[model samples]
Target: MPVELTIHQPSEIFLNDAAVKVKAESPAGCFTLLPRHIDMATALVPGILSYETPEGREVFVALIGGILVKQGNSVTVATQMAVEGPLGDLKNAVDVMIREEDDRDRKTRAAVARLEADFVRRFMEFRKNA
Candidate 1:
């Protein structure tokens, strides 16, 4: 029996297919899952997830850190984000994802700093009026 692999993002399902075998990376190291693999769950690191389809075609997906669960012949990967394409294209996708995340983080930090400054200013003004 082949394993049913489903990759899900926050907004929608990324990929759903039958895979003969699947490979992913975790904190401990890289691991491969077979159809009959024991049920388990692991925290996946940012890396390439590769799987062999029933027709023997290899597919690649670039994923940020996430959780993977294998129960029976079903494997589910839930991540904040994932990009799927040929193996050669995965690297470029990962690079773009990292840059976008970094930009978002920078903007978030700037917003938080402004909010903190405004709160401090208001507190100081209230103290003077008392």
Candidate 2:
């Protein structure tokens, strides 16, 4: 069975006439919903959400914040925010986001490492004094 999907956001709206299923990001992790997916909802986060149908994956809303999937043969995504652009534009945006995320993660790890080192040094000094 094929599923119908409609994607809407503040700036754009996209619809998929023949959708198989959708894979989107959630607070917990990546969630995939097919025609048999039980009705459920999840918190939205910055991530990639992709939709696929019998004709193949729909490229319109490949990147979205989050999605709400309904049970049955038809699936409707209710949301308030999304980033929409052409195929090329979307591709570029995704690349940029990936790069930025990698950079952010690296910085966060480095900061934690530095903080841990400082704490360890302080503890060593206090132990020596005692």
Identify the candidate with maximal TM-score: 1
Off by over 4 Å in 1: none
> What Cα-based lDDT does every candidate model obtain?
0.94, 0.68
Clashing residue pairs in candidate 2, if any? 20-53
Q: Model 2 TM-score? A: 0.55
**RMSD in angstroms, all models?**
1.6, 7.3
Candidate 2 Cα outliers beyond 4 Å, as residue runs:
58-67, 84-130
Candidate 1 lDDT over residue span 1-130, tens digit each: 8999999999999999999999999999999999988999999988799999999999999998799999998999999899988888889988887888789899999999999999999999999999
Model 1: colliding residue pairs = none
